[model samples]
Target: MRRLIIFALFALASIMAPIANAQWQEAYNNSGAFNGFHFTDSLNGWFSHIGSQKIIHTSDGGNTFDVQLNVALPFNMYDVYMEDNLNGWACGTNTGSGPGYIYRTTNGGADWIQQTHPASQSHWIQIEQVGSSIWFIGSQSVTPNNLLIMKTSDNGSTWDLTSYSQFDASWLFIFDSLNFIVYADEGLLALTTDGGNSWISTTLPSDYQVQRVSFKDNNLGYALVANIWSN
Candidate 1:
């Protein structure tokens, strides 16, 4: 299955247009469910399908999109991240039992090369990058429901692995080695103050649920929270 993607284009064309007057214009919608998308700029971007090993791209904003890469059969892309219009990576699995799979493309998704990893059946669901080449991925092993964070410094040539205790978290935010954060369980955030050596979970009040999370400094951050049952 895939999900629909909606792109919003700013409705401002003239210099005299007020910022409040700008509206969101519907841009693109695919036929099937596409799980992930990343826009390098207003004019270039790509989206990935959940199944059938497909990654679609659009160079002219959301006006059009074309399949840039598609592998053989049975490969599912759960997440995709592009560093720019020319360099990016995607992650998923190829079978029911997954050791996780990572693919790298240096030529604007014209060709994707599968990067190798160690022998652990992890189905990666989220991909993120730090700086130019350091990449991180979140994965869950199929057999035992184990979760892991995979990191690579030089593209995918080498990887460092860390296993954590959360099975339902999908977000990875790295802010140097000493301070890093990932999603904890259902309503928590996993924090690592001493790098990946150890981790602890924190959460907000029961009435609020974090819809999104981000951090700019080691101790400063923000969460988009929603009042769940508050009256």
Candidate 2:
């Protein structure tokens, strides 16, 4: 009984021991809302702020945020992609008719160059990288035919218009590097098997607006929905 009691006490102490915690410091604080955060690990990450016309980057986690660039485009960055501690990309939408922009950084967030996109500057809503390339989707209701899909192989140097769909502000995710799936407004869904070259739209009878979507792999996915109808 005494031996069992001592063992129990040792187990309890081990369970109650404090874990080694790493401290997170406020790396940067701009005068706007930070829309998205992407980090591969605690040492490297990127944050986008829309109202401030800036993207904050940290090579050593959130301990420091340096303004990589000041494009100050008319859009608010909603999402960011960091391929490594150095390579990163950002995509967001503009407020007015100004088209959105996709910016890339190669020198560890020291500077960013905007990709010369064919469509209007205010179109891209969300952007992410799937392997060595980056993909984005843009919407234009007035143009009716301006719903565009773009891909960049050389980081953000240039973009190729790959597909067109009448979807607005769609959320895109890539699985297995080239396979992708997008869920747009009005229950419109799309799947891409060859990078972003072609897409097939699927029907989803959902009354809620899907704000974000993530996939653990090709088989399992989780989506966060807002503006849902309870009735």
Candidate 3:
């Protein structure tokens, strides 16, 4: 009986080892103070690092990263969205003002142009794309008090704002051309099945300022939060 139990325990341990390894293998850790991240394929992905003042591009499935470009200002890139390698957008704060700025690149970050400056900007929290439609959401300021979302179909040329006053948070997320989700800290989490024309908000548990969210596919995703305490 003792030998049988030992054999059963060994078999269980062998089965559990691979499950633990698979979970770790699926996760990717950003090296620096990361504000935004995106993965186009299993092999190609990008992450924005504030401490490094550059974006890290990984073509070998997040195994290794190559520093792509270092911006003149080491501002925090709060959100990143790319339709493909050649066309992408990075949204974040500028030297001054709370309004976030949008930076566009056509040649895969070799050259970037300031596409839009927020005359009435906020802290951009998230960026996402569905087909040719792109969406961005943020607070009226960095306080995460007033949540707002902007939708554009013709790239970033024009935008339509949808306001949410009840929620004290905002975030941008897209799973595919058919599914997009947004969560505001003010107890609002929404989903859009038909691109960005319309949205549906559902109940959520907490609004404690979720910082980062990642998705491997439409079914699997995770949200990361940091704990803060005041003395």
Candidate 4:
């Protein structure tokens, strides 16, 4: 009886293995190159493409995607963030020779309006939101060595720019309106506890480049580092 029970358990495990290892089904196919995708829930999702001027949306868990916004070309959407089904933002470069843009969609990506900035810029790679304020971080082509950090308090109506003397700013992580962190090119990390008025800097091992930094809260955080190969 003991041997029979063990054989039964093994047979049951074999039957359940296929269901656990099921493959992901292809949901949508398009000619444009897809760059970024975001899903707020199981049923609602959005995706951005590089060559296309429109953003795709799906209401049925990606079974079918519809063209949600038909903005002009050259604004290749690089990243998208949605607070919910209704409020969201997308960022990308102009592909021509002008500054990039931050677009906001309040009605579930059906319509997007470009937000005004303090100056013409290049690319905005990341966006963070705290309450009603939004923050953007990206590089500017002032001399091929300029990095910029911009913030908007009235939901992208206006922006303010901050620069760090030749350091290439790559990522922005916001803990709140008063505190945030930025990762730079040369293993440099900047922390601000009293808003953007001042900052404290710390340098890690010079050989490793900081790629990304994230914080779970004010006290706990993690940094991803990559080794810089030298000639």
Candidate with best TM-score: 1
Give lDDT: candidate 3, residue 1: 11
lDDT score at residue 84, model 3, on the 0-100 scale = 84
Best prediction by lDDT: 4
lDDT of 2 by residue, 106-216 (tens): 777787777667766446666666667677766652445355677778765676775454455566776845687777555556777886577787555555455556665
Query: Which is better, 3 or 4, measured by TM-score?
Result: 4
Model 3 residue runs over 4 Å out of place are 1-19, 22-31, 62-64, 94-96, 117-119, 142-144, 172-231
lDDT per prediction? 0.70, 0.65, 0.65, 0.73
> Per-prediction count of colliding residue pairs?
5, 8, 5, 1
Could you tell me how far off, in angstroms, the CA of residue 111 lies in candidate 4 after the best superposition? 2.0
TM-score of 2: 0.71
Please give, for residues 1-231, the per-residue lDDT of candidate 4 as tens digits: 111112123345765787996888999887778866889999999888767866789999978889977666657777778889999988877765457777899999889888767657567767767887666767774566456777777766667787755457467678887787767556677888887678788867666566767665678676766666645
Error (Å) of candidate 3 at residue 231 is 14
Ranking under lDDT, best-scoring first?
Answer: 4, 1, 2, 3
lDDT, candidate 1, 52-155, per-residue tens: 57888889987877887777767778878898889898887777676777888999998988888874677787776655545555555664465677778787
lDDT of 3 by residue, 56-148 (tens): 778888777787767677367776666788888887765454667677778776776776643375666577675667777776664545667
TM-score of each: 0.75, 0.71, 0.65, 0.73
TM-score of 3: 0.65
